[model samples]
Target: MGQQYLFWFAQVHDDFRIPELQSVAEIHGFDLHIPQDLDASRPFCILELDHEEHARLLARRCILIRSVCEFYARGSTYEELHERVRQQRPRWSCYIEDTSFKFIVTAYNHTIPQARQREVVESFSYMDFLGKIDMKSPEIIMTCFEEYPDKHGTTRPKDEGDGEFKEVFFGRLIEEGSARPLVKKFDVKKRLYYGNTSMEAEISLLMANQTLAAPGKLIYDPFIGTGSMAYTTAHFGALVFGSDIDGRQMRGKDKQPGIIRAASQYGVAHCIIDLCTFDVTRNPWRCGELFDAIITDPPYGVRAGAKRLGRKSRQDKEQPPTSPQNIAFRRPDDQPYIPPTKPYELSSLASDLVLLARYMLKPQGRLVFFLPTVTDEYEELDVQSMLCDGMEIVANSLQNFGSWGRRLITIRKATTEHFAPPSFEQLDNVAHIPAHKDFREKYFQGFKKSDVEQISELSDQG
Candidate 1:
């Protein structure tokens, strides 16, 4: 049997925990066996890995995990736990002799007071080691975790020592997560250049993992506003190329492009090949299967609206010169000709993005992006409708924001076959009117205007 490793994950982004773990293992080419009854809502889960190196790889790459530990013993009560630890003494006894160690007591739902924390540590005195105590540095680090019931949606206050722990786990620390620091390192607030819709660091790192970004791989971001995913993907050693419909978003009043500026800020500027301005539907690429992965966060008409290259109205369409003398004069060099654009529908954009991924991504390559939807109207089948013939969904994790939520979708190109572009009828047959239709409209009107007004009135009264 493989060695069991307990993964203590950060409580944030619970839905992304398993997917990130699986992706990290897959990217490193390792076998990770997750338990059949794995509960992601809880902060801890034990996974079976072939070696300690595999656990270290997870710690080094996975952002959701806070730390990984070698599973020692676990039980619902301290008595049962002590018995298990005694039975497993042969496995851990080597560290008990001449080894400087420190113990950490932590809880999931409820905080353990300092007095109780000392008592809990004293309870483990049965394993009498003659080593000195080291809080800053230790040859061996032991951890005890108390898991209480999930209190996510509960509004009631938690009192001191009020809840009984559902379970307690004991383990020897393996490694603290190395990737968690990248979140603060690449924080958008600290970035030199960022836009209103720039993706936060944590989610961007999660998307990068979903893409399996690694050294020598090439990735593309179609809706690269301020180049959020580009930096994270590049930080993983992947070469990144990004594009946006509006050049202004990329240029950002600086002589150098904002994306490039931010990439330089993160010390990954060399990995960013170039940032271009073009409508994704009318991209400049003339080839297919050119990138290892395509990762992005497509605009859903919230903070910024999605746009495509086209005439907004018939009046803007090209008109033939009625006479030879009707020729238009060339404008001054200071003014450049700008193409007219039209609103790109969210539903159509989603289907087209899948088609683009099928065409651009290498076989077995991944396409990771976020799609926003109304919480009430969303369905599993809605996501299924946008997939192409050679592509399949790998993971779909949601980040809910009450009335509306954005789902981070990861799709993989499954086949090596070079299929023709999908026809309009084919797209029409599988298309579903997404819950995000008229999202910007409903985002304001759908939330019940009276409720908002009432809240505002209450705020004013206070």
Candidate 2:
């Protein structure tokens, strides 16, 4: 008689390419077998009876047994075992004499048909059989074949049906039963400003397209406002680190609690570090650590606090005091109110992005971030310049969430040997300049008339 065994695969993200279950089995010296014609995509596998001894060997080595057949030793034929039991007792009939032997026999036969083949030396009794057997002490119990159904929908019988059984591996069962449920109770999407419930599913698909970092590679996010980008990336098994200049935005009364909740829900390990409070116009990122990849969404002007309606006044003559012109503005009612800092000029945003690419990214590493179109005319030009500065644009696509139209840009840092040549469009041109002259003149004093003339001359020469 051969032993029987069961195999199963653990759930994982699509980006995790290794077949974890099969590898584990092979390591333990079990003959790996898939059900005949089983789809490779299916989540389970069935090793047949041919490798029974090998299965038992692995099971013992791997501590796979949930229960054991203590009363019935392995490799014992049914009739021979019964005869041996009869020889041990001289007056076994006395035990069955008072019990309903017929009923016991019927139930026992229904469960294990091998019982019927052996004649009872004394009259068979249900109470006697029940008293002799201990269900809880079994190291491995034999199950009827009626339970397992194949893909063709045919089920094997208890007796004549190969007695095919599935062993419930003790450790694996306990681990699965004790594991936390994947879906969280809260409406995760509702917690986000423009998030949808399908965002997780969509991100899972995008991560599948990229090569996953091995378990310890660091994934960084600079503009991690609510931690969504970090949360999604960490699901693929990378260690995530994130920072934001405005810690208040990440830790606001309403927003901070949500970040905590999301981190709890997703099982992402992270640390919130400050990216420094210097203004983007005056300072570049000073974070010393480099990352394998960076993915984030910077603030877009749509629905910004500066665009909110001001307080209504009873007297028409009451001009709202506008003396503090440089003060950042915010809507008090909104969670994590951001003071209105000077708006980002498109050229400055592009320049800051280029700087981030140079400093933060590892050679040949990737970056995926969202860039919104501030103005229609500059959309294509901004994208082109970013790509021309030694970054390879792998994917550029539209992301529509609520009323905002966002462009998702995926760029890979180029190695020195394969550095992308700077393009004509990337040169200082009028289209790359700020739209307001006064703001430009005050903030961009470093930019020279000669530089502007040089750009114009280059444009004409092109």
Candidate 3:
């Protein structure tokens, strides 16, 4: 058995909290003994780890955590909590004689008044610490949390005095979560170069964490528009390579590409190995097992649809001219040639991405990306159908947006065995149909019904 620790998490991104914690733990080579009955709606949970260092590591890497603490006592009432503290003094009393400490009072679904907080702190005064209270910088910190009933989606003002709590937890604080600040530091709105499709800072940082981005790792982003994921991964010391079907998204009409310029903005230019332009389905790389991980946000045709090099129809596929005079000629000053492309379906792209990962990723490397889908239509099979041989899904966290949602999927290369790349014919018929097959059309359909309903009401009034 390991030491039990209390994990206090940020209130936002509830769905991603567990997956991010699991990924960080796996990256550091440890298993977290999480309680099976954990509640996602609560901001805090108790987990068991081998050492205090493991808890600190999680606080450092997990963006969703607010703090990590050494668990001491938890009870439904203050009297019960105090009694438990007296009973558990043997585990925590050693530091009371020499350490300077301060108590922090926090509530999940409500705010605690400062006056009431002081009284709550005084309630635990029987521990009889001999050291002076130091508020500026304490050698030790004590945290007390009051778990309130979930008041999510309601806007009522908090009541005066301490409201009823479902439970109270007391602990010695270990470390505050360090990764949350990176969200503000990498805010996309503050970046030098970003397009409308650029990923938000927090989500990109989460994606980077899922890839286990760290020093000396080589990460590639096939749909690297404006290099959103590239910057964060590089910030974490990973070497990044980015490519896109359209060059303009990265270059943005400048001699110095926007990807490199933004990389410089974050002082991580050296970590960006290079940026190239090519259709992912027709990529130029001839090597295999080169990348440590492939992380990307494939276009979902919302703001911009994904594209590939091909004609819209078979009849539009033209062959080179055979006759000498039949061939078209260009002058020295003629406009540059532009390749034709067609809409790349989300389902087929996902299947091909898995195939590409099988060929390009190092053994045990990861593939982390986002897939948007109609919420009601999504199923476990939709993701399972996309997995190729030697690959397995590790995490699938959803970011819901009412009628639709995007899943931040983390798939791992499970085995070192190499599998033959599927032929185009085989690729076209891979497994069950994904929920995101016609997501763009379905997403719009959700809005159309509401508009139709509004018109019907107007007609009835008329």
Candidate 4:
């Protein structure tokens, strides 16, 4: 008279949840019957059957199912009432049929005492209990008392000494280890151009794990400030290559030796390049050379004074100063060069991204980049437009760290064999744009002209 039950775990993202469940199923070597329109909100379900062990096996694989409860009840205390009920019962009590009654016990109450809870749990027989209970409108109740230390200095409860009563009322359900599967670890540090932290490295590892980059595949990072992105990718078995405009900033005299050292420490192969320049407008990398994936955190509107060229004063501007304004800021060892324009524009930041996408990425390769969304339009709209034609946005997620609005955009190159551009025109008729007033009213709070000017100036330097 044992019973069977079906259990399921609630998951956050439906996209990966099925895969996780399938992985669990494979481990247990069982075929789970999933309803086509199953309700995720209702976490667990039970089925009455002869084989209870098979039900337990299914429960173990469903790690997402947090807790489970079974239905059972003992006989009434009144002997005369029981005898009257027995006289009305059917003759075949010992060999009950499966469809005898459909007792729906939806509610339960805990009634077991703490001291005798364990002993009570060991004595109850699931099979025997199922046989005795009336199937219709059964009361599902269990007695269990849990101990909690008095936080407000309250007195403890006096002993009642009812061990046998406790054993008859409640029992403990044992859980099988079916849920937590082993996850592969990527051991490396990640330093975002925006900032450096252990959390950023962990996030990068999570993103990399989602991609199909295999071991020995080249993972390139063009804007490898301190090699955080490169480090995380390499730790997962991909060969990493990182480059920075100023290699000195990567290691200097004391810090870790950039991506090269990071890869070595993590037991991954890597190469580092210094002062490499590639214009995004035109693909600069040699043809035929490509990477399996590219991940980077482009430099935001922040600059080091020593690393930046300064502007000439207004007083000296009319005369066209004999020496360039940035001459004073250049390193002592470096020779001063005259500025072609009054204030030499820093290298275009957006162009670097375009170059990386066009020249470096392989066909069907994936890219995960973090960009700050401070302005209404990103500076590299042209590059984005170009990418839109050949790439699909897989995920656009936001990560807010302090004042920065970091947007993580994951994109994958269109599979050329069966690729077709999305028909935006067809959807435009139904597309809704939030009113301009709504945006201005919500985001313009406490915003001043000076703040915009300051942000504009920062974007120029980088």
Candidate 5:
């Protein structure tokens, strides 16, 4: 039989755990089995992969997963779990032979005591091993986990809390999850440049995983801020490119210290192809080239309002005194023409982003991006709604923040059909992005009239 492995997911952001698994597996060439009814919110689940090496590869890139192991036993109760562990003693002994090992217990969704932990370890004393115990650095880590669900909506375990066990699992450590190291390496705290909407490193890496990023692949982000997606994509060896309507996000014409600093810090400075000052509504890419992935967190008009290139509807009737600070540099016979920015509707921005992906992505290449929504009013967006002639939905993962959260949606170009841009009406009917159309107004409506000044600062939050 093919080997069975267990992946331990952090209780936080459980929604992303499985989708990240599917993505990492697809990118690495492993046809992993995805359980249809699996509760990804739980601490652990068994993955039926073709080989042990496949499990190792998954652990290397997975951010939501805490660790991966050779699954030994799983059960609904302590009695059943111990019985299964006892049955595996013959094979277990062989695995432990000539190997220094350590035992660990993890009680998920609940707190465990040291005395109780020792009692559990003593229960497994019947097994035999030839090597000495090594706690600091063991070749093998045999683990037992007890999981419990909260008594109610509150995950906070009270001082007198004693939650009932929901499940039990046992496994041998294959590898620890890569999320920790990757997070430390690209943390936004250390980034030289960032926006109020500047992305966190863990989420950026998770998005990259969902995009199925890999070395030598081409990825682009249209709303690149502080190069979150850019550097994270480069970290995975992808050639990254990005554009934004806001020149301020780039800082200056020749200097993008934040972007350059981050890329340099991660040693992926060479992967950044270029950063263009272009509007998504009016895509500037004319080359026949296509990208392997298009990943972004588009402006929701919540923090930073969406904008586009345009001109005033009416010309100024008067010319005022021009100081050196406001003087226009031009030839004597030439008239300087300046372009102003107009409000770009959020619904239109969403439509444009998807259309851009459809036109520029290679067949089988993935388009991953986030869409905002209310927690209680979230209408799950299906890939069917955004389907073009050859596009298919690959994955959808959601994360909530108070009453608001964003969904990470990925769709793939399944065939070689040329992109045929959909009409505004046609695209609007596909998903619930209408909420974004008035996002800024509705978002600010929550505050009092006195808080208008704070809106500027609020828009700057990451």
Candidate 6:
């Protein structure tokens, strides 16, 4: 039987932690049972692994998981917890007698006082010791977790401590999670290039994690804004390639060096295969079924405007230069004409991405992308229809802050043997933009639209 372990998950991005962990676990062929429909808010969870290497692999891939530990004891009360630990005292003495170690306590929904924490640490000092103590760097790290009496993690004095804890756990730490430092390594504030809608490094890596990013895999990003997705995938050793609709975005518009700096900045330049200014709707990729994954954050026309190639407007026309300097600065006629872009609706963007992934992705390959829309708009569009063709939804994780939230949908291409795609009608639903609901109204749901119009009218009159 595999050894048992306790996983202390970080309390953030609650909705995404499970899907991300499960996705990675599936890739490694490690079957982990987390029966409690747990969220990040609940920090304590148990993981049963067949081997210690398997536990380390899980920790290496997870940013949400703070750390994994060697399972020691678990119980409903501190007394039970200590009693269970007592059972292992004979065995633990051998592991700890001559080892340098540190005991850290983490209390969920409650804070363990320093005095109480000291007591907990000292309680374990009964074990025979020969090695010198080293708190800065220990060969062995020990941990104790105190789960509160209720979901809120409240505590009571020893006089009335019967139900003070729902669960208590003690374990030997395996290794600290690799993700916390990665978060700091890829922090947006330190990025050489970023945008109004640039995906945060943490979430960017989450998208990469959902796909199980690995060395030699091909990852494509349809809408590579500041290349957060690209950088993350490349960082994982995947050969990353992507494009932006506007060449200006990649070539540098106003001192923004586009996505190239991200590679150089991150020192993962070799992993970046190619980044171009190509329309996703058009099949620019000649490498059929060559990509192993596709990760992107398609523009939602909210923070950044979503656009596609289309006919030029009335103001777009070539005119004779009025001066010698004007002619000198004029775009060379030999230069290829770059088409103008029109508004690209959110629904249409989803359709093109899925269709592109069908041919672009090898069967069983993954696609992870974001979809942010108003609840009303989302229902009207029927998000299921988005994956009706050529793919199946592996996981759908939502991170909703308020009225508007984004869903990260991970998909795998359905092979011919198991290819049961949605009918043409369902695929057609992707292009169908529901009735022109008040886009502005729903976006600013916090404020009334009528008042916005009233203020606009007043400003115009003034």
Query: Which candidate tops TM-score?
Result: 3
Q: Candidate 4: where is the Cα deviation over 4 Å? A: 1-199, 254-256, 269-284, 302-355, 374-387, 400-404, 415-462
Tens-place lDDT per residue, model 4, 1-462, is: 554333333332223333334333433455545456754433333335345554455445343443333322222222332343345334223424332222221111123355444443433322233433544543332322222222235443544323222112111232333432311133332221223432254445434543443466777776566666665565546776665544554554545554455555555534332224332222245453367777776654333211222235574667654554456666375654433222211123323353345445677677777654434432434225325355666555555433334555567766543332221111223222211112222233323456767767887998
5 Cα displacement, candidate 6 (Å): 1.2
Cα RMSD of all models vs. native, in order, equals 4.9, 17.5, 4.1, 13.4, 5.8, 5.9
Q: How far does residue 245 in candidate 3 sit from its true spot (Å)? A: 0.5
Better model by TM-score, 3 or 4? 3
lDDT string, candidate 1, 1-462, tens digits: 788888999979998999999999999998677778888878999988889999999999999999999999999999999899889888788987799999999898888888888999999998997799999999999999998887677676556444389999999999999999999998999999998899999999999999999999999998998889999999999999889998888889889888888899888999998889887777778788889999999988877788887656665556532332332244455776666677777877888889888888899999998989889888998899778788899899989999889999999999998855433222445346767666766676655557657767888999
- Candidate 2 per-residue C-alpha lDDT over 386-450 given as tens digits, one digit per residue, 9 for 90 to 100: 55466677556554442334565667778653322222132445455432222233223323456
Deviating ranges (above 4 Å) for candidate 2: 1-187, 190-214, 254-258, 270-289, 305-340, 374-382, 400-404, 417-462
Ranking, TM-score, top scorer first: 3, 1, 5, 6, 4, 2
State model 6's lDDT. Answer: 0.73
Tens digits of per-residue lDDT, candidate 3, 1-462, equal 788899898988888888888888887899876678998667888988899999999999898899999999899999999999899999878877888888898898789988889899999999998888999999999999999987779867666335598899999999999989999999998998999999999999999999989899999999998999999999889999999999999998788888888899999999999889898787778778889999999998988998887666754556542343332354233755556688888888887888898888999899999999878878999999888889999889899997789999999998898765543333545557778986765665573556757766888999
Write down the worst ten-residue block by lDDT for model 6: 417-426
Clash-forming residue pairs, model 5: 196-460, 196-461, 196-462
Query: Which 10 successive residues of model 1 have the least lDDT summed?
Result: 320-329
lDDT of 6 at 361: 79
| lDDT ranking, high to low | 3, 1, 5, 6, 4, 2
* Model 4: how far residue 165 lies from native, Å: 28
Q: Estimate each model's TM-score.
A: 0.90, 0.40, 0.92, 0.45, 0.85, 0.80
Q: After the best TM-score superposition of candidate 4, give how far the Cα of residue 73 lies from its true spot, in angstroms.
A: 22
Those runs of model 6 whose alpha carbons end farther than 4 Å from true positions after fitting are 27-29, 34-41, 87-93, 124-134, 148-166, 253-257, 311-336, 375-381, 416-441, 444-462
Output the TM-score of candidate 2.
0.40
Relative to the true structure, candidate 6 reaches a TM of 0.80
Off-target runs (Cα >4 Å) in candidate 5 are 151-163, 252-256, 311-338, 381-384, 420-435, 447-462
